[model samples]
Target: MTDHVDVLIVGAGLSGIGAAYRLQTMSKGKTYAILESRAAAGGTWDLFRYPGIRSDSDMYTLSFPFKPWTHANAIADGEDIRRYIHDTAHENKIDQHIRFGHRVTRASWSSDDAQWTVDASTDDGPVTITASFLYLCSGYYNYDQGYTPEFPGLEDFEGEVVHPQFWTDDVDYEGKEVVVIGSGATAVTLIPSMAGSTKHVTMLQRSPTYITALPQGDPIAGFLRKILPGGIAHRLTRIKNAAIAIGFYVFSQRFPQQASKFLIGRARKSLPADFDPKHLTPTYNPWDQRLCIVPNGDLFRTLRSGKASIVTDRIARFTKTGIDLESGEHLDADLVVTATGLQVVAFGQIAVEVDGRKIDSHETYVYKGMMFSGIPNFAWCVGYTNASWTLRADLTSQYVCRLINHMDARGYAFGMPDPAGASGDAAPLLNLQSGYVQRVAGILPQQGSSSPWTIRQNWFLDAWDNRRADLDEAMVWTRQREVARAG
Candidate 1:
């Protein structure tokens, strides 16, 4: 016997749970199931157990729109976020629909059947399931491994080396000298988090990234929650935070020089007087890559206290005791942490086939930043790179529900975006020049130069356009009989 459903959603993380909620509420009669690769929920929150694994984005916008984030802190810890996702699942009964330990390997679409046959690997064995539509909420990164660049003589290092993605309780750093490689969000986060217990901590970087400080808690959100209802307060806070994020991004893009100065100035004010300004400055303009955030200037405070330090230089090689810099500086360390970056993957790296033909994602153009061109009854959930992930994720879920409902009402068995409809030169799906994104640009999908096919990072525009989107625009709808007759 084969398991079947009206919808099969991949992942049980933030996006999957929200997708399930929207599907149940909006598309009432649809039967759905969530297939999670991991044994637990919370996806990224559950997978990454690093020391200072709190959200860089504020929780007000990062959290689901339907669920009010009652926590006082705007920047929430990883465990809190994991718990919140679990609580949401439990409250909505979404947990009952989740099949844990089932990692989807392949999805095959048949135009004749107007359904998808999905193959998944599980502890028990291989499992096959069929669904009318497939929604991939698996995120955009490889969960099994994080990206770490090959460093010369890495094997020669005598100290214990660890990657933030694979952090374990047994790997101790307390009272020991530690050096963290890369100056991304993970590095900044780990430096402050580990500085308290470590003898000394150093952040080693090839180049500097834009780093800034933000308050750990939102005072306005706390006030709103106290004075108004939970739902209203959540909505208002989400709007406020989202607006601020969008405004900042716009300002950064339009006035890169001023933005760079403002960010560097803030960092300069936070750091010690003798600290080299060159170490904090980057060659690229602001918004070229993502800016790292530290809650309440904790990282700066740690740096000022002499517990932690930053070194901006290329690696000469890894020594037995520490890494040798290109500038002939040597630092001793007991433990080395590679807080490098994540390996970006598309469609969870699951092989997708349509009517016995393998569909290459790179060749396909993105439709509304969610669906691929020439792909029927399928959607991928990816969040905004500039703002809290949940903001864009929520909009995507709602749009998926709307698309499903539209198909059902029109008696259409399947709907695919027409490749011909998308005009103009194609561009990379993601707009950021971040290392992680640039590394896998060849594998990711493409976006058109105009709306419906363009991926604009604006939340307000996406929300409004999604609400009023035309179901027929650049879409090819067909019924089962039509497919059969054509065949």
Candidate 2:
């Protein structure tokens, strides 16, 4: 006897939970099971325990469309986000379908059987299950460990060293000199949150990144919630915030020089007069990499108050007490935090095979920003890099449900994207030039140069396009009897 489901989701995070809800509502009577690698849900929100862990995007867009975010703050903390995910799961009874500690290692699709044979390792033993369709919502990063560069003479440092991904309660920084490496979101967040308690906090970056400030709470949302219904207010706010984000991204891309001036000018106003303008300047234009957001100008406030500071220089090596910079400056620190970046991986590093042939993701093209070329009955849930992740994630989930329903209506057993059906040169799946993305560009999948195949970062355009997308475009469908007869 073998356990089976109509659909199998690989994660229990925001995307997975949302996908489950969509499947249940849009594709009714579809039996599904969620496999979570960790003991708990909330994926990224649960894994990252560092101080000041909060969403870079507004909660209105970050949250699921089915569930309204009732919190007053638009920029929510990690714990709140985790609680929201759990509540969504419990409310929809989706939690009942999740199998914790079940890490999926491989999925093999058989055209003859018209199903996927999935294998997973668990605390109890190896578990095997079969599904008609597979939805991968496991996220893009390496969860086993975060990326930490090999610093010269790291062992020589006498101070406590830590990575934001692995922050623990026992690693105290109270009244201690802290040096945080990398000027990304984690570094900006850690500096402001830890500066007040620590004796001094310093952000050490190899180069500057574009940083900006946003209000923690949305005044318009607060006003709307007071007047309109919860659902209506949430939808309006989500749309408004999403549009603003898309507009800004477009503005930055269309007018780089003006956007750069605007960003730097805003930062200068927030900082002290004597602060060096050079430290705030970045070599690249705006939107070249993701922008760092500090809620309520907290990072700038910390800098102005003399509680925290920023140092831009290349690291020569780690000394006995602290770091020796290439600029002949030695910064003393009692603790060092490597806020380098995340290690990007495709499909949670799961080994996927079709007809006993392993999938080479690098050789495949992304179909409609979700499905892969030549892959049958599969979809990967990836979010936007420019806007809130859920904005795109919700659309992806809905689109999957639509696809499933379409297949059932036509009595199709499986559908695969055919690369020959689309005409365009191949491009990187992700358009960003960030270090983490560039590091794994060669390993990730490619996108076609035209619509349906291109992964657009604009949420507004995606929402409009997804609703009117042609389900039959560039897709090859087959019936179960046909597969069996061919075999």
Please write out the lDDT profile of model 1 over residues 1-487, one tens digit for every residue: 3789999999999999999999989999899999999999999999999898999899999999999999988999999999999999999999999999999999999988899999999998999999999999999999999999998988999999999999999989989999999999899889989999999999998899999999999999999999999999999999999999899999999999999999999999998789999888999988788888899999999999999999989889999999999999998989999988999999999999999999888999889889888889999999998998999999999999999999888889999999564777988888888889999999999998887888888999899998999978889899766877877
- Which segments of model 1 are wrong by more than 4 Å? 484-487
Q: What lDDT, from 0 to 1, does candidate 1 have?
A: 0.93
**TM-score to native of every candidate shown:** 0.98, 0.98
> What are the lDDT figures for the candidates, one per model?
0.93, 0.93
In order, how many clashes per candidate?
0, 0
Cα deviation at 324, candidate 2, in Å, is 0.3
Structure candidate 1, residue pairs in collision: none
